[model samples]
Target: MKSHLPEKIYLASPVWLQNVLVSTYGAFEHRRRYSGPHKKYVEYLRKNVFLNKTEIADLQSKLLERTLKHAAQTVPAYQALNLGPTPKLTDFPLLERESIAMNAEAFLSSKYKKEKLITLFTGGSSASPLKIYISEEARQKSYSFWQLFYDRMDFHVGDRKATLVGRKIQEPDSNNPPFWRYNLKDRQLLFSSYHLSEKNVAAYLKKLNSFQPKIIEGYPLSIYRLADQIIQNSIKLSFTPTGVSTSSENFTQKQREIIEEAFGCKVFDQYGSAESVVFASECEHGNMHIEPEYGVLEVLTNEGKIESEGSGELIATSLLNEAMPLIRYRIGDLGEITESNCPCGRASKILTELYGKVGAVIINEGRQAPTAAIAIAFEYLEGIKNAQIIQNEPGKVTVRLVKRTNFDSKSEEFMIWELKKMLGQSLKISIDYVTEIPPEHNGKYCMVVQNYYKFTVPD
Candidate 1:
């Protein structure tokens, strides 16, 4: 019998081979052209990041005007509104996920055909699943913005980077050696979030040591787990990254401390969504600076009025993504904006505070489980009005649900199966039916909560 394993798994295999395969596949099959739009956007971002406050705001206003005009002219949803030329930002109605979900085609531009546009989905962080459409140009521009942001830490394209996110690169049920898949095109080592147990941490560390990534990027919790294991076991690595970049989930202060201490580098926390409507990244001085070049972020009150300066719901209008221009889209997240300039001298708007979904760290038999695994299980499920995963004790999880009247037993069965698959089969899952799952006293609804134990990095 012949053994079946990736060539990269072999000790004798050359690393360049993996890179070649990834690049070739991405260019030909994925149709990813990393030159034209990406380069243009990168150049634009490089220049825009250093602009003064007034200049940045002026740039955003021009971009917003163009995007709003384009949306009003091309999109069916906007066309019905009868918005006048040079209409105020408030003149356009606020867009919601439900509106897009109900009629996605109406949101798309008439200029692009359905086949020509790229479809993307975003529900990892929230209950509402949104199906978004973007043009090839928009997709590349989005990637370019990320590249420019990463460049702040001296990271460039094709740099040796490791990522730990929700991608199902490895089989969920399989417990094997290659818990990560190497992407040669981007020179990225994609690690499986599902295989981050105590028994598998050694394998993950071994791969990281071998890969010797110059930069590490992933969800804050996932990276913290790896850092925790390394620090707790006193494991030394062959290489140290320049910095660690985190996104997708809320990067808490404690997680930041542990990651920085363990990796011996600063952690850059980035806040963005799949919608491409708003973007913010941490600067060298640790201030979260909103990129006005990307979008116009407005902190609005519950009554749809803009806040002069304080905490409120985040509503954004994309300066990019003209393919499906979302004007004043309610992002369903809370944050605060400040007029204070960063010590780093960047005059971009500052995000003083962000109160997004900070998922919990569930413990099963002394092993840390990724909250993403639980979050993903509920993705695209019907009749789930809202849900929350609470872990108060080890090996036990309480799922509080605000289900629709039509939610059936089959839905419950599927939820149980999904929970058991990630959290061990021996885990105790209690489904608690509720009329409503309210937010904490601070008015933030954290989907996942872990109260059992706090995993920390030792001095």
Candidate 2:
């Protein structure tokens, strides 16, 4: 996986070039303007986040009542319920992704025009792939909530930042140093998750140091890999960020330690999804608080009963997104709620733990590679029903793939090429064609498993 490209190439590149590209292409390609409602919602959330428990609950109740009334009146899917003037939350039935897919039109509000609707595609990290639509207002509100969270981290608009999400910014087969791009619109540096291999860590570090971002935001797994590399190489960064925000995947305790140690800053972990049904973020005190202004989050057991203070599957109902209201939506994630109050004075519900993807780390030549690297490699390949990576020993890896009807030798060749590009050619890669990929014993489908190397929080 070692690229012949010199590391100095990235360091030698002028910062103005990145700025120019971001200002031109980034602005034209992906530009979003916050609507009036979006700004109002953000301001409201800033005030509400510090409200007392009773006030917060009252506010949520009012929003819930409004959302339910809107869904009953405008959404075709909820019309059959014949909800009364004052409807309880339990009056609506639980909604699954299958139901949404089968009757997507029924979920749309007749109030919004076709032009206002925007379709969003999920990364298929979960069991079900979704193509959901939201109104422009809903999308902006989501962005507003993110801004509110960033503000809590002392981050303001137009701050120099870096993101390590699952964006395919690099060629799968290209072995190069510039595995990142700059977005001038938001002044953000976008890093390619596909190129975060052991061999390219130094190059990534070089570029990141050159950028000197004030905030680093990305998936926990991807950020952890970069932080781990920095620690292992004893790399001294010239610039220090105020905060490191993680989302999309689970932020483990071990990862928090490594990131905090490497960056000399706090790691603010966030738990939210594209569905916009539920949202939570870590406060300055490191307490994970569920934002009541975003949506109604309910922890339900397997029997479909609500739990007050325990671990269970998260069921959410979005109060925003009037264009396509999702009531009693079963967001496929696990969480634990606690009655303990946050000392930070935010009376919002506290989440003791939140679990999403448990991706493992593959050890090769004493260098650890995150499973996200492998996942991003095969993300573009077609005919993959489901894919899993398992590493039981050093220097060897097993790829378990549930292939679709079109899978062939060429598909295997493509996969091998992508894998070798990230995991060096010296390691042995065994592909196992299976009929199905089963979930773990706990009913969670782990995309990556490493039996040889286990990461734990240091005592």
TM-score against native, each model: 0.85, 0.81
Q: Give the number of the best model, judged by lDDT.
A: 1
Clashing pairs in 1: 19-184
lDDT of 2 by residue, 1-459 (tens): 112243224334464664464457666534454654777878877877778878887998999999998989888889878997777788998898657754667888888875668876442444233556787777878888888889877897678998887544545345576777777777888887756778888898888888999999887777888888888888899989999998766666777899999998999988876777877888899988888878888888867697656788778899877888898887766778876777888888888877665556666654444544556555545456667778898878898887766668877777776565555566689999888888766656677788887765444
lDDT of 1 by residue, 1-459 (tens): 011244215323443554455456655533464654788878878877788878977887888888888888899999998987776787887777668766778988888898988777665445544667888888888787788778877998678999987645443455776777677667788887767878899999999999999899987888988888887888998888989998767766777888887888999988887788988999999998888878888878767688645779888888888888888888878889887868888998889888775656676765455555556667545456667888888778898887765578877876676566565577899999998878777666667787777754345
Q: For model 1, what is the error of residue 21's alpha carbon versus the real structure, in angstroms, after optimal superposition? A: 9.3
Q: Which ten residues in a row have the lowest lDDT in candidate 1?
A: 1-10
What does the lDDT come to for candidate 1? Answer: 0.76
